[model samples]
Target: MDRSLDQLRRRLLIHCTPSQAHTAAEIATAHDTGLVVTGASADTIAHRLREKGFDGPILCDADRYSGPRRVDGGRGIRPAWCRRQQELGLVPLTDSGYLEPDNWNALRSILRVAALQRRPVIAMLPLAARWFAESHAVDDLARELDSYGVAVAVAIEHASDPFSVQYVVRHFLRLLRTAQVPVLLLRSDVAALGALCHGAFAAATGTTSSLRHIYPLTSKGIPRAAFPAVFIRHLLSYHRLDTCETVFARTPETSHFWLCDCVVCGGTTPDRLHDSDDQYSVALRHSLHAQLLLHDEIFRHTDTPDQRASAWHEACSHALFVHRQVAEHVPDWRTPAHLKSWHTVTDDPLRGRAGIPAQPTQRSVLFERPAEKWSAHERRGV
Candidate 1:
């Protein structure tokens, strides 16, 4: 997949969990999207890429050396694992530390370990924004990342709130301009998505390639929504921001929304992860459709530049029309009693462990800076 970058116009990144490499490889083949191998034991997962016919680059995780999930409390993001990925020739990516300032130091230590093993594609794990944009410290850190001579990608969030969609898009584009670090923006609102695309489409006349979208998508879970999320990629194409459908491959979870009767849907009646008739199925469909369609509406309904200047106007109309159809066809469902009770019972075991505490306030930070930064450094590069 040397030409993989040319194929994926939108640059899809699929989240692979529960099942890792093999499943990701399967998605790569089906959706023809890029692979981002998340979860622990990423080196092991990466080995499955070629066998599954995935030609695009793989995004290996920082899980093995010393995250909370490490077995035997093994040092997370192991040097050996990173070495293994280098040996296999996979592209690498590390999360930007979040929830606090010092998290960068902690993540930087992990990156140093990988550097010792000669890993490529080193990225900075910046803090995730709750209500504001990336701070000066964050920008300074990105500049430091640039100094390291490696590619940098920063993480940001788009939550389920009223301003979530526009806030992410606007601020993210702004960040890309200020920091020079590649930005990954998450979209969640269909109309806001259309509005964003329309805005970008208008701005695109003077923009360069660096200003285009670099969407790395994942699901809350495989959605059995009204339409397959692939439709979202199509909208991205209209502005040329989401381009290159010829090179990269995406993870299989990309086919999630088109449940049942589809090959990837796992056909067995009882095996259906969310059988259409299951009580959770209706809500499942909504949850799945809600976010993915935001992307889909942009691609499917957003008009091409040649069609008319009222592209966004038409896209909004189409999104509303499709939304109405989804409401009519998909059943009204609620969160299941068992799952809700589990949440109430566990009362959040994950909180303290991941450095998140009960009643977490902004004061409780998830990461602390590393005491040291260098094993010794010359320079690094992509």
Candidate 2:
């Protein structure tokens, strides 16, 4: 709580499970941001980090996926275990419960305790929640939560459809930004880019598909498939070309699809992404690099609306161009049709608004965009 919210500006924090604590720490060190350890095993992760000689700020998140009634409504107090961890020097964050409009009272109860303890509260608002989908409901929710002074973490629950995910992210950003709260987008890599463009403090996605994509807390775990692909931040999608042969044959050489100059993948082609025995590690590193790069690019523009609008425009155009390239080059690529929503926003920025088009337009511009084509090599100055 002592840290100023402004410190989150242009920063990227990696969210991980207990098992991924070491990798998360490395990513934090590489990106120069704090780490957020979540899941039922977070306490174990905190202990492991301490044992491993990690000396940095660690946010211990209580997993709220068990049952809403257990911890909702003042019945769910901060566990003694979490309190002990906090005393041991880990910052405590609430488990991200699937909060709906009706659950405001429960959230209020949780925030009250955190405020009393002077803890920096992390509120996870699921986009699928009815309250979050409506502007008026969101406005009311923001007004209520603003009193507690907590940071917002958005979770998009298991949205496989690209357009639905992007729409939810954009709408949530627009509504939440009104509260002027420091927002962190959870999962959804493409939406995270859009969040930053709209002035979110930070955004997070996991190293694996399970980590990168958000699913319902109640859903059963699905088996993961090994797909070696490069995450194209500009396009807000992944290119699933596992082997060098696949990449070379599937994508045009003239297209910059195979290029990346991140320290993890420097001078490497997209096909090399599958060369690693640990494809998970490779994907995580690349995802982190893409996020940090996008954050830096958007951060370069000041907090002014006009500058943000320009940045949004530039990002959307690049994403559209890249999407076009992919569709033309790889006819079979499953590009989400909703990807065009970014262009629509770019064209009107104020598509749904009815006004003189002066102040509102500035605010609306932030929610637009789908992807970009900027090569990591070009962006990294390689």
Global lDDT scores for all candidate models:
0.34, 0.57
Candidates in order, TM-scores: namely 0.46, 0.76
Residues 1-382, candidate 1: write the lDDT tens digits.
Answer: 2232223233334444425345344434443345555555655767766665567656564432222322221122445544566677765554323323345556556445544545344443433443234355545655654545444444332222222344333444444445542333222223223323422211100011111221212344222224212222212211110111211122222222222222222221112322243323222222222223333333444344222214333433333333343334334522222222222222222222222112112222212212222211101100
Candidate 2 stretches with Cα past 4 Å from truth are 4-7, 50-57, 66-82, 126-129, 161-167, 217-223, 226-229, 243-248, 300-309, 346-382
Superposed model 1: Cα runs more than 4 Å off:
1-9, 18-24, 63-78, 95-99, 102-104, 107-119, 124-126, 130-142, 156-167, 181-382
Please name the candidate that would achieve the greatest TM-score relative to the true structure.
Answer: 2
- Candidate 2: 10-residue stretch with minimal lDDT: 356-365
Give a tens-digit lDDT track for model 2, residues 312-371.
655566666656665566656555544565555444343432221222211122212223
Show pairs that collide, candidate 2. Answer: 158-214, 234-371, 234-372, 235-372, 319-371, 319-372
